[model samples]
Target: MKPITRYLGVFVCTALSACASGAPLSSGKPFDLTPPKTMMADGIFYSQRAWPGTVPMQVAIVEIDLQTRGLSFAVSSGRASDASEYRSQTTSTFLRESGAIVAINGGYFSPVVSAEGLGQDAVGFAKSNGRVVSPASTPQTAGAAKAVVCFDRRQVQILAALACPDRFANGLAAGPLLVQDGAIKVDPKNATRHPRSILGINASGNRLWLVTIDGRQKGYSEGASFAESALILQALGAAHAINLDGGGSTALVYRDPVQGPRVLNRPIQGGVPGTERPVATHIGVFTKAKPKT
Candidate 1:
């Protein structure tokens, strides 16, 4: 079920129907591996999963073509108290202010890997003039003004959380994590999703690598592990990739399948909720560069 097809179904009814209509047989099923078309525009690339599935929460993954431009990532809490606010914070506010297009949910939490820091040990070092200074002394202290910014650089970035005590103790302790450059396959004793095979794939014709957590979630019945999702992204030609926020918060929005640009994925808790928690980040897609006019 391609996203375009599923999104087409949503426009005809309330967005909630998109999820309710699918949950009967698809609540626990994963998407099939049928590669979908990809397009690039306005410094961003857009692509949807080949198969259709309900996310049951708010989330998205977007790749900001930062090959020649600078980029940054941050998380914030809003007054509206819903997932849409988080998406707007990244797309309309954070990204707009900094001119960064790509964003995702959930900031990577770690001592050295906070949204405001460098790599675990700086193996593939890149120069940066501006620093992502901490907005608060602690994560609990972060507020609406809190954010993380990445200085100008040309590398497939990795945003991940440490699942173990020594997730990145040494330069190579991060695990079998796939980055935009390549796969840093590391074995961990405290594997969070141990016994579950993950899928890995290189995107952007192998320029980006995308990894996903909670592959066994409903829409990913075909996905039993993160590795499986990686393969999906790889088949899509991601050069380097990493997992974003998944589970109940995994939502994807796109243009209307039958019409035009519209919300493509279902992102709500049980299809109803007063206010959703503030997501750390989000992902938004746009067209590739425009022709000279």
Candidate 2:
């Protein structure tokens, strides 16, 4: 559990300044989704914006340089299975417990609401630290979990669920692939909006982006559709991206050395604002602390 201050930086924008002009920040075409403020560290950058639109939205983005030495990724693991039960925890809990610098909610799971998200099971394939935590769901059983992302110490691969490999150091399934081979894969007709969590990679595959869009809170942040989410990632330079488990489980947590673990988004669960829903799986990022200045 190293102190995050050695590897984390903080920056923020006032709501007044971000929305004063009532104009979206430049982010190419289709839509304007870049956050006004950006926080940067040695190998990581974080940004969040209060986007104004017919449906106002709030978004948080974290980009990490995979080529940075000592960087690693992890997926939450559960107890051995006799049945198919898995343990669950909030994203913030996962960040703190796993000693990861950043963490976000992972794939979809059953029993949307539970006492503590115990006895839950991932809706699709899940592997943690080389262990097959759960197998891929069959076509009839797979709903939103249509794609998978697998990663090792130095590489990451995104593939359709059916093509997922038998082994990977860490991986999870959760998507209707948003972008593939630098093209938008999300159908424009699928316009349903809700809070969202997405994972993406740059064309070179040396950068990884994690995003969370807050929604369902009228007059604040209403959320974005799959198409919008994909466009957002495109604007951020992601060539490939996938939607993760969202809705009440949409959350991104960062460990701030000074402030401790903090939830970067206003998550609404069970109709309660700021409430965090315990979820079945989470993806975490680790990095070596920067040398003292």
Candidate 3:
């Protein structure tokens, strides 16, 4: 996928500085819940809020009924040669185009490197609908990732990569698991706050959450750290959760009966008309159209 505007580098640089000398972490509390709004449809629900009194943070959450809807992974380009054609788009483009009810960016991989199956794509693995769309090799280094999360549409699981089963109906391997069994799992060293996108599933495996927290904008939202994200998910009822490709790549889109398709969060990067940064993959929730009666 393509990189975002120049400020992204600055965002990272500033993040380091702030991490070293920022105020104490947020108190574990429920979201402030102002401007309360929600949307509900067949097997889906959406809501948003802004946490205040600190540095202000914006977050959007979508809950999908896995039993009534479908959950799967998608990529802009399916073939190696067509890689350039489908590199990036706003999360909504993938959602609206794929007709998904809920969606978020998937996994981490350099498009150019992955296109040739060279670096992580050569090592990291992704599979969609029972086929090995991306291959895997030795994990390069131990603890390269804190956790590996995958799903088979019917169920999603989190664990060490070595313990992850061989294949799935559709899945992605990306993490630093934010919440496990409803407990926060952030390492103190990785506790820096930044805009974050996270995915979570309930113990029942029948409900899923797609979340995004906006950051890097002063007086608007400063973002969330790995621990904050975990607390947020747990507050929303996630028994298991994982952080996905975040930073400027964080994006969330929802379709409304009246608003149609809209980007619910203010994506920090090239999210202008026809300019959402491209990403390696996407996770989406869709429902099978019932046969006509």
Q: Which lDDT values do the candidates have, in the order given? A: 0.30, 0.78, 0.61
Off-target runs (Cα >4 Å) in candidate 2 are 1-41, 81-84, 290-293
TM-score for candidate 3: 0.75
Candidate 1 wrong stretches, greater than 4 Å: 1-43, 51-102, 108-154, 159-206, 209-224, 252-264, 270-277, 282-293
| Winning model by lDDT | 2
Top-down lDDT ranking:
2, 3, 1
Q: What shift in Å separates residue 222 of candidate 3 from its native position after superposition?
A: 0.8
Report the C-alpha displacement of residue 1, candidate 1, in angstroms: 15
Worst 10 residues of 2 by lDDT: 19-28
Which segments of model 3 are wrong by more than 4 Å? 1-25, 32-37, 69-77, 80-86, 111-123, 141-146, 162-167, 189-191, 257-260, 270-275, 289-293
Please write out the lDDT profile of model 2 over residues 96-191, one tens digit for every residue: 889888899999898787456467888888888888888878888888788999988758888876435765689999898999998889777877
12-111: candidate 3 lDDT, tens digit per residue:
1111122112122365344542333343455565566666436688787877777764435443334455433235455666777777755677766554
Better of 2 and 3 by lDDT: 2
TM-scores for the candidates? 0.42, 0.85, 0.75
Instruction: Report the alpha-carbon TM-score of model 2 versus the true structure.
Output: 0.85
Instruction: Give the lDDT of residue 227 in candidate 3.
Output: 77
Residues 1-293 of candidate 1 have per-residue lDDT tens digits of 24444544432221222321111112345443232323333343333343343332111233344453433222332224332222223122333333323323333222222122122211111122222111222334332112222222333234332221122111111223433444433332332331111122344432332222322334433232344444334444454444444443333333332344333333332332211212334333223333111
Q: Which ten residues in a row have the lowest lDDT in candidate 1?
A: 164-173
